[model samples]
Target: MTTALVTGASRGIGRAIAVALSERGDRVAVHYGHDREAAEETRSLLTGDGHLVVGGDLADPAGARAVVDTALEAFGGIDVLVNNAALAPSPATLHKIDETSYEHWDQVWSQMLDLDLRAPANVSFLVARALISAGRPGAIVNVGSRGAFRGEPDFPAYGAAKAGLHAMGQSLAVALAPHGIAVTSVAPGFVGTDRQEQTLAGARGEAIRAQSPFGRVATPEEVAAAVVYLTSPQSQWASGAVLDLNGASHLRT
Candidate 1:
């Protein structure tokens, strides 16, 4: 059975991906940043015994190593690496972006750059490097967002980070092609996850749904299905492509 590591698997899209992979008979390393109980719930939902529950702050280099090491130790080697974990900027526009107390504009940008862009790329690099050393061809799927393309003016930092991530995925696809490794970015539209439900609460979410061409937002499962297919043998030759799973509302004319 193929072994996969899925970060942020405690809930939402990550949880769905973990369950889907497990159902297909692949062992999964479910990585969660916080909320151990939620992570365990994900593990419990798995049909088989190949799922491992790993939790830690991936922003730290050591923590990142632990996430990958534990999975490798348990599953022997990783066949798939899903960089599904991310953090959005707190509710504030560029005028009020003060989450980081850096003295200069460049410094703050660097901090945001590290968290949103560098972390996933670093983690993917670690996993892909290991796979190369072990003589195994693997797949790396990054859960990006349509924001990477849309460039929300209110959330410039996030959009920039995601855009960088998409570009990095393309570069890795070419760099790892000779090794038979595939790197793909799965960009989802406004997904109706728990966070979305709470944030959009009541009439606002309803109104937004009505505006969509499909009259509803994409679900976590829909995005998970895309990730699974990209990792499957049918898409082995597909890499560096950004698969937009939006509901057609965000399409460019």
Candidate 2:
């Protein structure tokens, strides 16, 4: 069975991806930043046994390495890695130009890039090296954001970081291809997650849904399903691809 490591698996899209991988009979290492309880809930929701819970701050290089080491210790080896952990846009993280102070902007930009871009790159490095040393084929799926293409005026850092993440995945895909490792990324638009429920129920909800012809936002499960396929062995040929899960809300040429 495949041993998968899913970062930020405590909730939302990360939880859904963990569940999907577990349902497919892969032993999952659910990594969380702080919420151990929520991570345990994700572990309990899995379909099979042998699931593990690991917690660490991905922004810190040492913590990121420790997370990978913990997963490796428990699972013996990691066959799949999902870089889903990120500092998403929120009221506290919003830094719109002209409205926010330069200091605030710098702080938010640093934080977003650290967790969203650097963290994933570091984790991928550790996992890819392990797979290579063991001489085993593996796959990596990065959870990127559509904001990288459509832009986020209020959270420019988030958009830039995601763009970097997608580019990093392509670079790694090419670098690791000779070792039988495939790396791909999924850029998802607005997803209906617990964190977004309030916004979806507010007055702007209709306008948000109207962005896509389908008249609704994508669901976390749908994104998770795409991740599942991208990380599967059969999808090796799809390496370096950046799949869009935006429901046609945003298209890139």
Collision count for each candidate, in order: 0, 0
lDDT, candidate 2, 1-253, per-residue tens: 8999999999999999999999999999999999999999999999989999999999999999999999999999999999999999999999999899999999999999999999999999999999999999999999999999999998999999999999999999999999999999999999999999999999989999999999999999999999999988899999999999999999999
After superposition, the stretches of candidate 1 with alpha carbons farther than 4 Å from their true spots are 89-112
The list of candidate 2 runs beyond 4 A from truth reads none
Model 2 per-residue lDDT at 103 = 99
The worst-scoring run of ten residues by lDDT in candidate 1 lies at 92-101
Query: What local distance difference test score does each model get?
Result: 0.84, 0.97
lDDT by residue (185-222, candidate 1, tens digit) is 98888888887777567767877787478898988999
- Give me candidate 2's TM-score against the actual structure: 0.99
TM-scores for all candidates? Answer: 0.91, 0.99
**lDDT, residue 69, candidate 1:** 88
Clashes of 2: 0
Steric clash pairs (candidate 1): none
